[model samples]
Target: MRIKLTYESLDGDIILPKHYNYHIQALIYKTFTPDLATKLHNVGFPLGKRRFKLFTFSRILEKGIPTKDNEKLIFKRKITIYFSSPIEDIVGNLAERSFKEREFKLCNKKIYISQLEIVTTPKIENKVIIKALSPITIYSTLYKKDGEKIVHYYKPIDKEFSKLIEKNAKKKYHLLYGKDAEQMSLEIKPLKFSVQENLKIIKFKDTIIEGYTGIYELLGDPELIYLTYETGLGNKNSAGFGMWEIWRGKESDEDA
Candidate 1:
């Protein structure tokens, strides 16, 4: 349910906003059937609740590091996308419409689909460790001094972190599946992490949230784990947050 994509600048140069992750996600949805695309795009549909969405993605990468050449910034050759929904429509939709040499708009700039590769990650086990392929953003209500309410555009590890992740992960599971998700014995503990700060789209506006790219220990139902894998671990997943990959090992091991 994941794909590695390589796009080349159709015009030999392309420019994107520094916070361009959401744009790439949109292009992917537009490649699907019109109705599905509309469904995916209408984030507020279904009674103003996103109850029928699935999938996540990794960061759009550039070769080594991005280099600025005057007004244009050069990017890497490849980026990746992941889909967790087992719905045939999404898979079939993309397969039918993914035409080679197709053009896409990222941050209103043009790029051609150069290469596409499907990748498979390990299935959820009774207990497994997961690492973030992209940063994760959660929506939580926290109170500050004088009872000020804080919207978690980005939340640090707090008493509510574990509870929020579990709550949201289960809620997404129910959204994808009609029945209530079978909450297994689970502990969402952040073992290792590095702060990932960035801009995210909320109500079509730029917002700063404290997101993190890191690893967590999961002990729960296999289905729950798989659902998290497909849809992402936190909110705004459909908008490019909370995608995960299996931890290979220490960076020095160069595990492949």
Candidate 2:
């Protein structure tokens, strides 16, 4: 399930740090009951030895001007965000709590829920085009001979990019359904992308992340495609990377 949330600032403008993923993440956790919040935070849904949070959210959708030497973003009154999860409890808890509370603090700025609605699921086919709402990231952590840890971020065209994403999605399927899916192949191919324009660098708390934003064609089983829609694509989903929506090519322009 998915939900869209629109927030309006009670103050004249909403000001926030340039890298505010942590703040938004914190706000989402706060919307849950204390016990639920603690469990989701400390111990997520377990599948084998690994635990999955099973939730992902898009980056804030708003126009804002950077100020104070690019340290902060100042937005006029309102912002919108999309959150998704296959787990009904996670999605339901967020919507119910936000509606009941109505008001909350984001980056210490007073704000109220101006709008909240469940987003209808689109018909996901075995093959479809998608555009990233947040950058999709795939990486490997390697330790050097000198005992130095290095994060190697991959471009969408890299072989490991598709391999890792397909692997990740299968794991999600197994975790969600508690059974293995039938053997099938999944492929993600970039459609519209530019290295200079689409490369994104983000800082979440103290960690620097490299990711990419663009349109891509996903070819796979329909079930896996739908799972990707709800749980997001690639890696670091809970930290606000890899949320995407379907793009209907020329139809999108016509609709706009």
For model 2, residues 1-256, the per-residue Cα lDDT tens digits are 9999999987799998888888889999998888889998899877777777889998888867899699999889998899999999899999999999999999888899989989989998899999888889989889999999999999998999999899889999988887786595578999888767788888998899988888889999999988989998978888888888888676442211
Show the colliding residue pairs in model 2. none
- Write one digit per residue (lDDT tens) for candidate 1, span 1-256: 6666666765645555556665666777777777888776665223234454666666664533345643234565444455444455665567556664277777666777777666676777977877776676777668998999888554436656666777777676666566675544445767675444332333313665456666677777787777777777877776677787777667612211
TM agreement with the true structure for every prediction: 0.78, 0.94
Candidate 1 local Cα displacement, residue 52, angstroms: 4.8
Candidate that would win on lDDT? 2
- Please list the residue runs of candidate 2 whose C-alpha ends up more than 4 Å from where it truly belongs after superposition: 250-256
* Candidate 1 lDDT for residue 87: 58
lDDT of each: 0.63, 0.87
